[model samples]
Target: MGKYIVIQGQNIYDVALHIYGAVEGVTDLLVNNESVSFDTDLKAGDELIYSDDYQINKEVTAYYKMHGITPASGEQHVYPKVFSLPKTVEIYTSAKEVGVEFSVSGNGKIELDWGDNSEVQTITLSDKITVFSHLFDSTIGNKRHVSMYMQGHINQLDISGLRPIELYILKSIPIERFVLNNATLSIDSLPMLETAFGVSLDGLKTNDLTPLLELKNLMSLSLTQTIYRQPTIDAYLIGLVRQHDNRRNCKVVMTARPSGEYREPTRDSNSHYRITSGMEAVWVLTHEPAWNEGGIWEFIINETTYKYEQNH
Candidate 1:
């Protein structure tokens, strides 16, 4: 069949005129290149077939071959398209749950490999926002390698899950928050908690402040409404606040109340004595000014010059 390579600003009609000297040849052109839309503008590298009896000119065929253009077989390969995932996917290995929210831009199927040597999970994607969850067994290692395949390309991520204390020698999981208010926190789990940006020990029952002291990156510690009422626990937690404040050079806000319906500890003279004694008796307490309105107080350590600020 005769073939013509469509160049810039050229259409089927133009190709017909150039090849057969008549616009009526466009019908033959369309019949041969049925894959092309009649109204669509021809791309610069489009190959238009004209007649089955007429052979493509040797020069034009060589030109197409040199440019790596192959004759279209009338079948087009369409791949699935995907949009960028909205947020970082966080999967809690301890809970064995995947929490992800994203949108698919094109038609395709998504395959998720949870890196546990298990069967791959697949889901169909419609052109809309999708929020889905997947539950699987906890991954074995410190770092979980999950692969997502869409179309023919693959996107992978090293999903960090809850790591055991034995894996502490390895890289720490990039966890931003650790919330175990009423749950029993083992000393071994302290290493995993070391990298948390925020740790909430609101209702912690353990008196072992040693584990919490290791969390040097803590930004906020909530002790306001918890079951911690022991004098020693209070003292140790105050010490933890001091150590965290001095080491991180970040103010640690400890929320407490003098009296409330909650059965938690009341910040009394005993708590004050523990705080002072824990700070080598060099700590000074200062209450916020009356204009502050809120009954806020500050405990300053003279040695490290760390302030344990408290807000009512």
Candidate 2:
């Protein structure tokens, strides 16, 4: 004969008393998905189905473990989640060092891991919110990983007073990837030997990409859903290619739309196309703005050259 525990169709009260050592309310725990109380009883081979809440708890635990992050007191921020910014403000996560700024005031969050066992801080300001800043003073060469969440909104951002190499030093890494969605970016830097690369503006009306001159490590740039007229596109693309050729030997990829339903590619599309010493090659793609179907432009860089003509 096998030992069997019986539920007997009693409410949680009766079952808890019999199976657990004088412990009642075990059934309520099962229904509510609370941690099993110490007194709850169960006989051999007794089984209880898990409630929905149990699954949610398990997922949350898994997320924390994978991302190595936790929530702060009085705040609701989770790791591996994207954040956006509301306004432009200077921050000093590291003393006396300038940080990036956003043009439009809106909600933006950052994936942050402060040095010296500091908990990750995630913040999202409202539309009226502006000037998102942080402080960092990790020992020089101590690298940290920070990410921004832009999601699907169209906005503009700029990183001022930092060269491409300085950026790498700040992050403690060489290869950096930035994501932009329906947004425009303006980087301000003087001519330097180092190279940097990132996505171009989707709807940029500006003629010069001189703001991006010092980014020698630039590899991929996406320009999917911008509202540039044909002439603006031609001028911008030509000028960009020329600039890259003149500075660091880096290859650049320009993307655009050919028709409402067709996509195309343009490589070294400048009038006086000259390959840079570091540039392996240049590629341009013309496609419908992904935003048309609710998608942002994607810039996938396989090179990091910034070649543009002095006059486009």
Candidate 3:
């Protein structure tokens, strides 16, 4: 007989293999730890018992009797075990879509309160990862307050979903870290990034950079893997500096290393002059000269400053 403490990703078979050098001992281990079933999701710090006696523990025998689970006298039963609801759930909403993802440890249904005076929705889920998505109705207003409910026991009961922009306007929450890699952001959605101190739009497929100028509080911005041409990049930088000229003092930081295909600079020489004066400090990430590198650029205009880093 022996006791083992479960670690992350360690299952009953793993414990059996570690203790008895064979997975065939898993049934024996379960019989000793009758409180735990074969389908139980083990967590770290859980205690497990293993032995060669093959005697079913009193707790397990009681559980089987209470649940009316039975098998032939000589056979071992492996059925779905009752589980508690997940401790965490995530909800994401965009302009047109709403998505919810969560884990279910057992068979159950989830109830949702959209908080729009609409009928509550219930969804059945099995033991697995569950994802629910729906098209958002514009009539529901730009903001949505959502609540989730489940039948089983859990640590948290009040979960709400709010739009990124709503969090800023209603709660005065300034977004410090934002990532939109490979996402198509609409002009109307740009306001969500307005108060963000740091933002990444890598692999974005937008043709308009003008909307980004509205991010007056932006400290660091990454446009890596974006589809902006040299002219568009120049225009965006110029516009950003002009908008910030008298509002705040800012600095630009860049690294010397270029990634991606090299491209020619924009044709406007006046734009280059603005880059030199308005740009407090420019760092080039490419092997090319700081002034010629097409990857990253920094500029400061009067009281406004911003740093940009890009990869081909």
Which stretches in model 1 have alpha-carbon errors above 4 Å?
1-171, 241-246, 249-312
Off by over 4 Å in 2: 1-175, 184-208, 244-312
**Higher-ranked by TM-score: 1 or 3:** 3
At residue 291, candidate 1 shows an lDDT of 17
Candidate 1 weakest lDDT stretch, 10 residues: 152-161
Question: Model 3 Cα displacement at 171 (Å)?
Answer: 9.8
Return the TM-score for candidate 1, rounded to 2 decimals.
0.32
TM-scores of the models, in the given order? 0.32, 0.27, 0.32
Model 1 lDDT per residue over 1-312, tens place: 766777766656456545553335567777787787656567878888778454333443344446554332222211122333222222223323343222232354656555342355566755443444444432221234444444421121111222211112223434445444444333344554465655555544544555666766655555434444445444654555355333342333433322212122234666733333333311322321231233222332222233324552
Model 2 — TM-score against the truth?
A: 0.27
Worst 10 residues of 3 by lDDT: 153-162
Report the Cα lDDT for candidate 1: 0.43
Residue 301 shift from truth in candidate 3, angstroms: 19
RMSD of 1: 20.1
Per-residue lDDT over 206-232 for candidate 2, one digit per residue giving the tens place of the 0 to 100 score = 334554545645555555454445454
Query: What is the clash count for each candidate, in the order shown?
Result: 0, 58, 12
> Model 3, residue 179: what's the lDDT?
54
